[model samples]
Every structure is written in structure tokens, then in C-alpha cells.
Target chain A: MDQEVINSYIPLFKDAFLLTVKIGWLGIALAFLLGIVCAFILYFKIPVAKTVVRCYVELFRNTPLLVQLFFIYYGLPAVGISISAEVCGVVGLGLLGGSYMTESIRSGLEAIPVIQTESALSLGMTNGQLFKNVILPQAFTISVPGIVANVIFLLKETSVFSAISLMDLMFTAKDLIGLYYNTMESLFLLVIFYVIMLLPVSLAGTFIEKKVRFKMFGD
Target chain B: MEPVLKIEHLNKKFDDFTVLEDINLSIAKGEVVVIVGSSGCGKSTLLRCINGLEDINDGRVLLDGETVNPGSRNLTKSREKIGMVFQSYDLFPHKTILENAILAPMKVQKRSRKEAVEEAMQLLDRVGLASRKDSYPRQLSGGQKQRVAIVRALMMNPEVLLFDEVTAALDPEMVREVLDVILDLAKQKRTMLIVTHEMSFAKAIADRILFLDGGRIIEDSDPKEFFTSPKTERAERFLRTFEYEK
Candidate 1:
């Protein structure tokens, strides 16, 4: 644990941390959007689209993020489709996270009692209005815990972004260890930065879960 | 005067088991009709069928001379004219009582928030829940929640209101408060079709009492006549059970 080595590594780790946060959040955002859309598709049981979304969820959930990244970055290039490494990392993470999100959200949607739907419809709500106003709000509240978990899982999954040459936090740590061989300092900073990324997310998640539960279920 | 709602030869079945059969009835505007029966006699199913909540095997439901086609775009428009409150007091658990009351008016009827909230406040106040407008459903007693459910249905100002066992799920003490709200509506001549096991409440609130047995209307008469001297033996036997329980 050399003080000089640790101080020198700070700038590199800072840049890597910023890159990880940016890509991780973007991927998580994409995952949430994809998850909600796919969940609704399955919830409504739309004919062909439901099967397609099911297959997409299964395909992504079953495969590793590393393989998906490799396929997007290296395998697709074989077919003359070239996506940059940043895009590859974000897309790979989003595709993988989307599957988990779909299941999480789908369960939330299902947890709503049948009476809610009946109550909404009986109030003269169209299918769209009922879903948007009544179903989605309750379903989202029910989904907060699962969604927060997904966000954290997706953020941690960003560690594999190095496979696509994204220069994320993991890449910087690995590069520093290879060059300086300061295994202790590099690894320590890596753990610190990763914790810095994940701790707030988990804490924020718990806070939100509590707040929503209180709002929904009351004191 | 034309009826506000008319059910003609309605038949509903699940797979092969018949739930509602050959049900035909008409409700005039401002009439309070209470349908009472033994458990599993299709009272709730009849109300669900009237609201287009249950898919009918055959026959049609007409509101103001327009047909309601279940699972069609027409049904959505038609549903706005018909309000229903359920046994479960299905107030959105995540929403405040105010939000639960105003959601359909603001979203479905495209009313402004100011107007919806104003109307919601008035209704909530009428139901003695004005102070709890900001409270979630879980915070309220079962009786209070049911009152909120009633307010939510009334916000839509439907041509006809259907209550499917609204008070059946409430505590014995909570039952009167909810029934009083319906009685108030009955006094206002709000068209309502209620299904309840509360025989005395039915006698007090109903202009007409429908006695259903085995998925058919066995008696449709004035409340006094039906209660004191039921025409059908089945009605006599049904009323006897309530007496037996009492």
C-alpha cells in the first residue's frame, strides 16, 4: 500500500468511475424502458408480440452479458455490422437487464388484484386509460424493490464492459495492475470505486422502497 | 319513459357450467332495484353481466337504446354510462381517497383537475370522509374504504350504478354506514341495481325486489309484497333462511 502509488492512481480511477456511472445509468434507463414495454406486452397477452417478447426475455436472460457483448462487438462485425464499443457495452447491458426487468415488472403487474381492473373499467375507463392511470401506477409501486435490485445488478454488470474495450472502471483497474503491478493499491481502489458506485444505489433503493410502501400501504 | 338499462335474454356460461341464464330485466331511470338470493344464485353475476364485466353467452344489454358489445370499443363508451362498485371495495391501494375518487373523471371523462377535485371533495364530504381525502385506502376502515369506493363510482355520474354485494364484505357494524350511503342515493333517485344479503336493508331501500333462484328471477315485485308475501315457494324458502339465521 504505497501512498504515492495510490495518489497517482486517483485520476485514472476517477475517469473510469465517471465512465462506469454514465454507461451504467444509460443502460439501466434503457433496461427500464424495455422492461416496461415488454411487461405490458405480456400482461395484455398481445398475440404475436407476446411470444416475441417472451423469446427475447428468455434469450437475453439465459445468456451471459460477456457473451452478448462479444457477439455484439466481435461477432456482428463478421456480418459487416459495426457498433462502437460504448454502444456495445450499453446495448449488451440493457438487453441483459431488460429480461430481468420484464420478469420483475410482470410480477408487479400481476400482483395487482383483479378488482382494481374491474373497478377502473366499471368507472368507464377505456382499456388504455385504465392501464395508464390505474394499472401502471400501482404496478410501478409494487415493482420498486425489484426495479432497484435490477438497477444495482445492471450497474455491477458494467464490470464486463471491458470485454468490449469501453475503458470502464474494470478496464482501468486491470490496466493499472498489468503496468505497475501494484496489485494491492489497484485492487483496493477498484473495490473502493465499485463500492462508491453501488452503495448509494442500494441505499437509495431501500429508501425508495420504504417511501413507496408507506405511501401505498400507509403507516 | 324509456328504461335507463335493459337486459334481454342474457345468458352467461363458463365452459359448460351455466352461471347466468335467460336473464331479462329493465331498470327505469331513478329506480332502486335490489336483487337478493341465496349464495351462488347468480346475483353478483347478474350485476357483472349488466356492467359488461362478464361476457354473455347470448343476448344483449342495451343502455338508452344503444347495445353494449362486450370486449368491443363500444363497451368502453357504454361503460362510462354505467358505474359499478364491488364487494372488495377496490379503491386503488396506492392512491389517496381523493385520487381514487377523481381518477376516472379526470382521465376517462377528460374533466379538468379543478373540477374533478371539487366534485370529489363534495362527494367525499357527503360520505363523511372529507378529512381523510389524502389518506390511502389501507389507512381507512373497511367501511370507510367502501364509502370511498361509492364516491369513486359516483364521480363518473353514470346513467345506472350497479353494486355487486358492496356491503357483504364489511364488518357487521360497518355495514350500516355503507348501506346508508346507498339509501341516500336512493332518496336522490339515483338509478342503482344492488345485490346484497342484507334482507332488511333490501326491504327498506328497494323500490322493486328481485328474488333470484338457480340463475333465474323467481319474483319481481314491490319490496313490501316480496318480503311479506313472496309469490314463489323458492322466495318463501329464501326468506325463511334469513329468518332462520336471525
Candidate 2:
């Protein structure tokens, strides 16, 4: 309820919000790329790569993002491989998000009826053409909801970046609370900023799901 | 005249059970052959084998004198010339009718979009579905979707057309619309191998009737002769089943 405290924290929250958005989006983009590739590898059952991707998915999915980030940020330096806090945050989030993405996309790919493949093949589509024109588009449309959820999940996971000295929104809020004992104002701004970050993505996801379903089914 | 499609000793098995056994057949150019029997008679499997959809356990299929190998690179090329319309009217649900029709022509045949679309529109118009070209598959009735499927197959200008119970899934009234389309194609002397339980439609459209029973061609004779005086007792019994319905 302190107007002065809230106003004073605005500039700091702004900087943190921008940083969070930057790293969060970068991580999500990387996650999407990794997810698609890994999903295809598993879907097609490509020889050794399938086993490798399966292990990768299991490993990342079972471990918490917090733990993964800890390893990348804190444990890597002992092995003589040091990365910037920003790089560590992005890489950790990307790896974690990618596993969930792979499952989401793999489910989408599997949900496509076998008849679809037979139809495409009967039409004389080469394997590559079938995958590109027929399979990928349908699978992607089917996975939109899951992919969006992963996006939001990965963005929230960026909060843990504070542990590695990244000045993200959560770090900013906690720092303010600890230094100035302004817990109420800081926590209020944190909640507002998080909502600002997630609300549009959630709405966009629902809009896209509806639009795609209508386009596909014409209802 | 050489045969457009030839199957020699074609055998298909799923583990221990044999689906098709030693099926030898040939289809001439511009011929209309209708294969009819009870369900599980391998009629659909025969069409699938000709199109290289299923891997045969023995024997080979030849289209235009070239082998149709299921696992070979030439399978795609062979499939381009063999158009198949399924019972479910397997039109791509995501695409509009026009897109579904024009896809194979554009992507597989490498035809220009304008050319493919132009051909597709004409074919759709032929099937009385030109007005519904922009509609998705789910928006159309079963018959309309089958018509679109027919247009999609015709867009390839294939050497042979295979109809695997194309009207079996349609409503009683809708069956006529799809059958009429096939009957029209028959008038054009298009080479087609159709598998259907519609005995009357089969008799009307078929130049030759192939009655399959237990994975073997029990009878292959002129439609008039086969309809009137079936040689085999099984064919007599199969025809008797249809008579009871009438």
C-alpha cells in the first residue's frame, strides 16, 4: 500500500522484466528446435540416434530444472568449462524445456492416424515430401497446446536463474525485499510482472488452438 | 494388347495366417474388372498389393511391364501411376477439397500449380463438387468426400484406378452419387479394378467379374455369364446370398 515504495521499484522491475523476457524467449526457441529434432528421431525410430534421444529425454525430464541449472552453472567450472550466467541460464532452460517438448510433439506425431500416412504414400509422395508436407504440419498443429504450455513452463523456470547471479525479475524482487525490507511492494510487482509475461502467451495459445481446429475441421 | 497390371503367384501372409495365396491375375488396358465376395476375401488386399502398399510374401506385381516392388525406390514412381480410392474416403482432413485434389499432381508429378488446379477443378466439376472445392473434408458428406477422393486420384492421370469398397462407408442414398461417378468412369473405358459388395453395381460396371473366395479366384468370367450361371458352387452360394436380400 506504500505508493512511494511501489514507484521506486518500477525502474528496477522494468530492467528485470526485459532481461527475463530475453532469456526466456531464447531458451524457448532453442527448446522448440531441440524438441522437434528429438521428436522426429524418436518417431521415425532412427537407429542409434533413437536410443540416444530416448536417454536424453528421460534424463532431462526426470531431473528438475533447478538441479540441471545448478549443475550447468556451479558444477561445470570444476571441470574447467566455464560459461556466462546468461549462457548457463539459457542452456539449462533449453535442455529442460526440450524434454517436455519432445514428449508433446511425439504425442502429436503418434496421434496422426496411420491412414494419413497411407494416403500420402498412395498419392506418390516420397518419404521426404510426405514428412515435410503431410506429417510435420499436422503434428505441429496438434502440438500447439502442449508447446505453448512448455513455453510458459520454461519462462517460469527462468526464476531459478537468480541463483546463478542473473538479474531476472525474481532476483530483482528478492533483492529489493532483502535490502529495503519492502516485501509487500516487491512481491506485488513480482506477481504483476509474471502475469504480464504469461497472460498473453496463454491467451495466444488458446486462440491458435481454436483457429487451427476450425481450419482443419471447418466447424 | 498388353496388360496394364499383372500379378503372378501373389501371396500375402500375416504371420501364420495367409491373407492371399498364389493369386495370379492380369488387367488389360482400358478394362473394368470388378472383384466381389464376402468380407475377408482378400479383394482389398489385392488392390493394395498392386499399388505396392503391402509387402508380398511371394510373387510380384507388374504395372506397365515394370515390377512394383513394395520396398524399392521405384515404389513412389509406381504409385504415381496407380490411383487408389479407399472405403473411408481418406481425403486429407487438413486440406481443402481443391488442395487435396491438386496435392499429388503438384508435389509428386511436379506439375505447375495453375495446371494442377485447373485439372483438379475440371475433375471436381465432373464429380459435381466444383462448388465445394474450398471446403475441408469434414465439411462434406461421405459421398462428397468420396467424390473429392476420386478427383484427387484422377489428378494423377494414373494408368489404373483401384476402388477399395469406396461406397461401402456411404449412407444408402449417398452410395448412388459415388457409384454414378464410377459408372461414368467405366463408360470412358478407364482401366479400373474395383472391390465392392454392391453386387448390382459390380454387374453393371464390370467387363469381367472376378469372384474371390478363401484367397483364391473361384471364378473369373464374363459378368453376364457369372451373374446368370456361376460355375462354382461357392459362387452360386455367394450369388444366392444377394438374391435373398432382393
Candidate 3:
């Protein structure tokens, strides 16, 4: 029972944990914001941006998150656009998660009846006002559950960062396993980390979904 | 007399399908006009066009002597002077009934919140839903929602109100309640263009009844003459198919 080896991994574990949190949280926030903006643009079909968003969604969604991450991390350097691995991870996750976020939000937009928009228009709301005041508020509320779920999935998917040597949680765990060779202990801790991090998100999603459903349909 | 709403050869087409064609109508101020037709006869389309909700390719809708330009960038401002009630009520599910009623006045009319709420409460009272102001649309029945819809339309103090089959979605018993609200609105002398299938309701309150068939105004007459003796064969046939229960 070498508790010393496990304890030695603690500082590395702390650094890696913070990095994962940093990348995941930042990535999730940026992705959600971009997703909502791009989704609305796509939903409303706003000129060339609409087509660009469409291609962006298809490009990111159709490809693997890992490949997308690798391309941003490794491929971009060849194009003379080298960014920090941390930046690469964040941007990669943001773009990948944004693609899915756009789809989720697009579905929310579709779920809203055209009658609602027509009603808003009849009430004298400009298109921008209609989206800001009516459509976006309702759509965002409805899409909350889906967005949170996607965020959690994206957070878990951050494990793919080990491939990019970003020194995220999984990367630290692999390092520990290589040295201490305690696969069970290290893997178990990683699972615990995910569950702990994602529990609040899962609960928040359920709560938000219930509240929106209640607001929309009542108890 | 200058009609509050004037439609000259109005036509609406959805793709290759013509929904409303060559429709001509005029509604004077403070007049109640009821448009009646079977399903897909363009009655709703006509109402929507007047409110600037539908695009009409071939004609113009003038409100208060000014042509309602649907394609213009300022259509929202044009629509601000007009309010509409749908068969579905279309209340914002996220907002309380009070918020739903007050939103247009506060946002579009630029009325202060206190002023807006005061006006909205008055409208709620008119619709007999003052106590339900805090309630959401989901909490209200079909008839109550329709009544609220009527009140919501009036909140803007619109010169014209468009009701597109407001009671069609209600149950048999619920229809009368919504119609009663419309009847009450009619009493206030607000110009209203209503599209409905309720023959008796039309016969009772409408200053003029318009029978639409194949996107044309087949019969436009006073209610008494329309119910007693329709002018067109299409009107007679439509009346025969839908008998009013005495």
C-alpha cells in the first residue's frame, strides 16, 4: 500500500484538474454563446452569415471532435497560426460544442410555432425586437436542458485533450499510471472527478427543464 | 365616408396555390364586419393581410387612409396601430396574462410600466379576467384565453382589431363566452374585422357580413338580408350546409 506514490501525484493532479476546469468551463461558455448567436442567425437565415453558419455546423458536426481538436492543435501551426495548446483546446471544444449547440437551439426555434412569430409581428415588434423580446427568451428557456446536457457531454469529451498533451485531468492520470502503474486507483479517481463535476450540471438541467415545462405547460 | 380599412383587389398566393384572389372590401370606422366562409376560403388570409401578417402580391391594404405597405421596413410601426386576436390565442406562454396584455403598450406604445399595467388591468376587467391577471395562459381555459386575446388586442388602443376565428378553437359552450367578449367589444364601437364561422354570432353583431368563396367576396350585405336571403348561389349553398340552431 504505497500511499506515498498516490500523494506525489496530488500536486500534478491539482494543476491538471484546474486546467481541465479552465478549458471546459471557458469552452462551454464560449460555445453556448456562439451556438446561440449562430443558431439564431441560421434560424433567421441572415444573408451570407446564414450560409457560413450552416457550413460551420455541418463541418464541425459531421467530423469527430477529436479530429477537429487535432486539426486546430496540430494543423493550424502548419498554416503559421500557432496558438497555445490551452487556446487550441478551448477553441476546438467551443467550435465542436457550438455545432451541436446550434442544432439543439435550432430545434428549439423550430418547436416554436410560426403563429407565435406572426403574433409578435402583429404586435408591432421589429424582427430584432421579436427575436430579443419574444423568440430568443422562449427559445433559450426551452433549450436550457439540451444545452446543459451538451455541455456535460462536452466536458466529458475534454478527455480527448490527453491526445494534444494539454495536461488536463486525463493527461495527469495517464502520467500517474505510467509511473505508479495503478490503473484501478487512477481510473477510479478520474470517474469520480467526472461525476462530481457533472452532478450539478445534470441536476441543473433537470431543474431547468422542469421549470420551463411548468412555465410552458403548467404543473 | 372614408373606410378605416380599404382593400383593393387583394391577392395572396402561397407558392402556386392562390389563397386569396381579387378580394375587395371596405370597413368604415366603428363598424363591425364579420367575414364568414368554409375552411380554406381565404377568410383568415384576408384578415391576416389587413393586419399586415400575410403578404399579398397583387393589391394594397390601406389602414386609416394610409396604405399598409407589408414589404416596407416600417411594417412593424404600421402594425402597431393594428391589433389582432388569433383562434389559438397565441399568448406568450412564458409571460403572465398581465405581462402578455401589457407588453405591447409598454414596449410598442412606450407607455410607462405603471401606465401600461393600469391600462392592461382595465382591459382585463373588460374581458372579465381581472383576477386572473397573474395567471399564465396555460392556466386559463380556451374561452378565457380567447377573451384575454381580445383584451390583449385592445391594449394597444388599436384603431382596427382583427379577430381571425377567435372562437373557432373553443368548445361549443365556450364559444358563446368568447363571442360575448366580441359582442362587448363591438358595443365599444371599435372598428373590427372578424373572420368566423359562427353564423348566428355574425348575424347578431355584425354591421356587415361578408361571405367569401374561392377567394372572392361572394356576398356582402347587411346581416338580416344575408341570413334571410343570401345574394349568391355559393352563399346559399354554404348557408344550407351550416344551419344555425335556433
Candidate 4:
């Protein structure tokens, strides 16, 4: 509620918010793409790719993303492979998100009944027609809620990038507070920034869930 | 006459568990054959094998005198010729009733949307489900869904249709309504292989009844003959049990 203190840090906050948006958006998009590819690779049981994705999902899901961040940002530089903090943040989040995303997508695809698939097959549908008409529509219904939840989680998780000096909203808030000693006011702005970015995403999740259900069941 | 559909010495097994043992059958162009059996008698497996859904350990399924391979890359040509309706009324929950009916023709037959819709509508109208064509599956009753499933199969203009316990999942009252639609199809002389427990419907529609037991057909004869005087002791015992249960 301290306008005098908050107003001074607004310019820095804006840059951090923009950076958060850029990295979070790119990170989530990358995760989604990777998740889809991994899920399909498992679904089709592609020889080498399936095994690779399985091991990747297992490795990432079992560990903490924070440790992964340190390993990528701190540990990679030891081997002469230096990367920007922003790239490290995105890579860490993307791998973590993609691992969970694979499970969500895989389960969503698995929830499609064999009967529905067999019905489409018996109708003489080619692989393309079957996917477009049956599999994709059903998979979307199963995957949407999980995906939206992941997106919001990723938005909040962008704060973790501050450890790598990525200058996200959390880092900006920390800097302003350390200099001005306004802990509550600075943290309040960070919370508002996240809610602004994420509320619509949660709403979109419910909207898509209802629409897909209605299309499938008419209720 | 060359059989429209034939199963020659079809032996199907899953691991060490045998489902069908040296099964052989043939259906003429307009024959209505009913397969009746106790539970676990491989009747449904036989139907699935004919549709190439179940890969037989031995023997081949011939549709129009050509062997249908389950593992073939492009089996659509054979699949489009042999239609199947399941006990669960496996209509696409996402599509409307008409869309379910038209999917095969539009995709496999490569017919234009208008042509497919036109033919699909006629089939739906014939089954008394024309008004429900635009409706989703959940909006309909079990009987209505089963009828829609029948129309969906018929839309392909398949050479033969397989009904694998279509009424097994319906309530008692709903069963008759679904069976009545099949009765109409029977009157039209559509070639069909039916596996059912509804004895009266079988008696009414079947030109021949094949009684299966222990993964073997114990008796294959005219419906009147099979019911009146079952040839095997096992067939007679099966009828006796069903009669006692009723």
C-alpha cells in the first residue's frame, strides 16, 4: 500500500516482468512441444526415441528442478559449455515441465478406450483420418486441464530462475527490497504480477474442459 | 455357390489358452446365420477373427474369396467390406449419429460429403433414427444407441455384418427394440453372422443355428431342427440348461 516506495521500483519491476513473461512463455511452449513429441514417441514405441524419452522423463521427475537449475547454470560452466542464465532457466523449466507434461499427455492419450479406436479402425479409417477424427479430439479433452495447471505452475516457477541471476520478477523484487528495505510492498507487487499472468490461463483451462466435454458428451 | 464369407479351419489362441479350435464356417450372399453358445465358447472370438480384429493362430478368413490379413498395411479395402457392431454400441461419442454412420463411406469409400450424408441419412431413416441423427450418443437411450450402431455398420454397404452380442448390454425392454431393428435388417436379406443369447430372435431370424461349446461347434443345422432336436448330447444339455433357467 506504500505508493511512494512502490512507485520508485516500478520501472525495474516492468523490465523483470517482461523478462519473466518472455522466459516463462518460451519455456512452457518448449515443454509442450517436447511433451507431445515424447508422448507420441512412447505411444508409437519408436525404437530408440522411446527409450530415450522414458529415461529422460524418469530422471527429471525423480529429482528437484532447483538442483537441475544449479547443475545446468553452475555445473555446465565447469566443462567449458557456458550458457546465459536465461537459457539455463528456460532449459531447466522446460525439462522439468516436459517430464510431467509427458505423463499428463501419455495418460490423456491412454484414457481413450480401445473400443472407440477399434470402431474407427473397423470403419476402414486410415491412420490420418483416425487421428484427426477420433484420437486428437479425445486426447485434447484429457490433456487440457493438466496442461493449464502446468502453465500456471510454470509461471510461479519462473521465480526459481532468480537463483541464476536471470533478473525475473523475483530477482527485481529482491533487489528493490534489499536497497529500500520494503519487504511486504515488494513481495505484494510480485504476487500481483503472477496473478495477472496466470488467472486467464486457469480460466482458459476450465473453458476448454467444458467445451471438450460438451463436444464429446453434449452435457 | 461361392460363399460371400468363409472361415476355414480357423484356430485362434492367445498364448497357451486356445479360444477357437479348428473352426470352419461359410455364409452365403444373403444368409442369416446365428451362433449360440454358452459363455466362453469362442463365439465372439470367431466374429472378431472374421473381421480381422483377432489374429488366428491358424487358417485364413476369406471375404469375397480373397484372404484378409490382419497385419496388412492397407486392410481398409477388406475392412470396409466386413462391418461389425459391438455389444457396447461403440458409436463415436464425439460425433453425431449421422457422422458416425457416414465416417466409413466418407473416409474409406472416398465419397463426397454430400453423397455420404445422403446415404447415411437414408440408413438412419430406415432404422427410425433419422430425427436423432444430429444428436450426440449420450442424448440417446441404450436401444437408440444400438440402433444407431447398426445403421453405422450398414452405411458402409458391407458385404456381411457381424453382430457380437449386440443386445447383451441392453436392459430387457431395450433389448427387444434393438433386436427389432435387426429384424428389419433380416427381412431385407442383409448377410449377417450373429452371436446372441436371445433364443426367440435367433429362432425367428436364423436360417441356420451353430451351437458352439468348448471351443467347438457341436451342432450346425436348420434353426427348427437344432431347437427341436439338437444333434449332440452337449447341444441338448446346453438347451436344457437355458430352458431350465428361463
> In lDDT terms, which candidate is top?
2
> Chain B TM-score of model 2, please?
0.98
Residue B170 of model 4, lDDT score: 93
Candidate 3 lDDT tens digits, B1-246: 988889898889999998888888888999999989899998888888887777779988888778886787667877988889998869998899999988877877789999989988887887789999999898999999888878777887888998888887889999998888888878989898888888888988999998888888888899999998888888888889875566
Better of 1 and 2 by TM-score: 2
Model 2 ranges off by over 4 Å: none
Q: What's model 3's overall lDDT?
A: 0.86
lDDT of 4 by residue, A74-122 (tens): 9999999999998998899999999989988998888889988888878
Candidate 1 chain A weakest lDDT stretch, 10 residues: A210-219
The DockQ of each candidate is 0.76, 0.72, 0.73, 0.72
Per-residue lDDT tens digits for candidate 4, residues B178-204, read: 899898888899999999999999999
Chain A vs native chain A, TM-score per candidate: 0.96, 0.96, 0.91, 0.94
| Residues A49-107, model 2: lDDT tens digits | 99999999999999988899889998999999999999998899899999999999999
What lDDT does candidate 3 reach at residue A200? 82
What TM-score number comes out for model 1? 0.93
Which tens-of-lDDT digit does each residue in A1-219 have in candidate 3? 356655666677778878898999999988998898998798878999999999999999899888998899889989999999899899999999999999999888878888889988898877877777788778877787788789889999899998988998899888879977888777766776777777988888888778777877666
Each candidate's fnat, listed in order, reads 0.96, 0.72, 0.80, 0.67
Query: When superposed on Cα atoms, how far off is each prediction in RMSD?
Result: 2.1, 1.5, 2.2, 1.6
Q: DockQ winner among the candidates?
A: 1
Candidate 2 versus the native: TM-score? Answer: 0.97
Model 3 spans with C-alpha error above 4 angstroms? A1-8, B15-17, B244-246
Q: Name the regions of candidate 4 deviating beyond 4 angstroms.
A: A217-219, B244-246
